[model samples]
Target: MENSISVVEGRTLHEISLQRKLWADLTAASLDFCEDLLQWSSCGNVAVTDTDLDRVVDRVLYMYVSEPLAYWLTGWFALACMNLLLQGKRDIEVFVFGAGPVAEAAILSLDHGAAHRILCVSVLSRHGISNQMLAAKLASKVHFKLDAVKDRTRLHRAGFVITATDAGAPLFEPHEISRNAVTLSLGIDDMPAEYFEMLFSQGGLAVGDDLVAMEARNVDPLSLYYSRRGLKLTEHGRADGVKNYSEILSDATLMERLKNWKGPASFLPVGLASLDVAVAAKIYEMLSITLSTKE
Candidate 1:
């Protein structure tokens, strides 16, 4: 009766708990699948779509299966960026800029050890605590520290930051960012304009899923100028130029650039059709096996 009781909307209390577990497992799976895909010798090219996935319907799923997956893909890309930024580095201090599974997934994907302390900074009130507890519960080797946004000092020590704040203003000051920091930023507004100013003043690297398509679409700070409203058809800064993430991984040059890149760099990995398809396919495959064995 307890599991059957409807709490909110159409979901029962049972479904809500299942959703949390699914979020964590799916996060881990997405990261592993992407990493394996990168190393697959037969893999050739990746295609991406900006379209939302909504064909499947479930009372419990809500928008989780829809196009919002684009947002989670941004966090998955954080793995590639972190590896490049902190190569051969030990005792890495990872600071995640958002508290949800999407941001925590970045921490979950990282190399686990005694020395790694992941400082997960969140803006959510109670929801933030819920996510962190689930993450800390699931985290065996890695330590997940939940810190509020008001305690912004944690950002200063982050070597690899996975940010999914999707914020409209600076969560932390520009000076707080660690030198030569690399972040997987979900959008242009994830950090303050002043931060970008500082990055561009020195030298910063920027990458994406498909930069040319993004340039044509006029999304993200990669575009020279953009409007806050009025069709975003007019909406859109920093770094020498924006390169595609896949291409960077495919070649050693850009990874090398990221290795030696100075100042603070950010990555925008959302809106890629490739990522959505990959994640969807991976989740389906994994879930099917999990459901089949009743594990």
Candidate 2:
């Protein structure tokens, strides 16, 4: 099958070339071969092969696609946190609810100098332990105090709360969150319906990449829950008061809405296929440049 991959950035979808058989045989691959592949793919000069196309696509999707997408999402979260800090004009405390891959990526993406403090809370002991190790490794770069805490008190203090878990229910009560707090929920069902209702009732800002797509897929936990309860996406649900990311133009505009926020502001980014393509395209460009310099 002939495939044309495209990445959506803001409102535009740009096409990207796929490197045919880039990992033709991983075990027998050499640095030069990898470098050449990168150079070719980056320039959109690679060819397509009919043989083992399915296998190639599978490997690329699972291995290459996932990481870049995670990184992209994390980058957005970082920017949002920065914008929130800029709007509030104060030192910001962050609470990460999960220690999973997405959470780790967000932690890695944070500007250490900008963040005042970071607290990571995990229901799973193993995740907490792993995040503890990760925090230690990141200590040199991170100027803030990174703590893996069992206490939930920090949740009330955090101005930025990120939920990246796979939990089936809400982790904390909506009332616990600070009035001016900004919460980014990447987990499917992490935040309960009540939380969203509170956000909407209080005139807090709600943002998402594509709430329509998430609801159509029936994969988003909040979307599914609200559907079962006979609520529409724009009424007391995940998409309630949600503005698409594409609509956001500048940090100043974001801050304008945030200035009057009397309750928890939220960002719910359900992973988009276009984001994977976008990140993959960026990697291709970088690899090409690196290979060219080496040669």
Candidate 1 lDDT score relative to the true structure: 0.51
State each model's CA lDDT, in order. Answer: 0.51, 0.55
Writing each residue's lDDT as its tens digit, candidate 1 over 1-295 gives 5655776543345544554453454456565655554343323233332223344565222112332244335545565566555554555566665665555445444533222533443333234565456455445634555444434556677766665555544455678878677766654555655666666666676666554455555545444322333222112221344445544555666667655555667776546454455566665554445455764
- In model 2, which residue pairs have backbone atoms overlapping below 3 Å? none
Question: TM-score for all predictions?
Answer: 0.59, 0.66
Root mean square deviation (Cα) for candidate 2: 10.5
Model 2 CA deviation exceeding 4 Å by range: 1-72, 81-86, 116-128, 234-240, 250-255, 259-262, 293-295
Rate residue 284 of model 2 by lDDT: 52
Give the residue spans of candidate 1 off by over 4 A. 1-31, 34-72, 111-135, 138-150, 216-239, 260-262, 282-295
Which ten contiguous residues of candidate 1 have the minimum total lDDT? 229-238
Query: Clashes per prediction?
Result: 7, 0
**In model 1, how many backbone clashes occur?**
7
Error of 1 at 201 (Å): 1.9
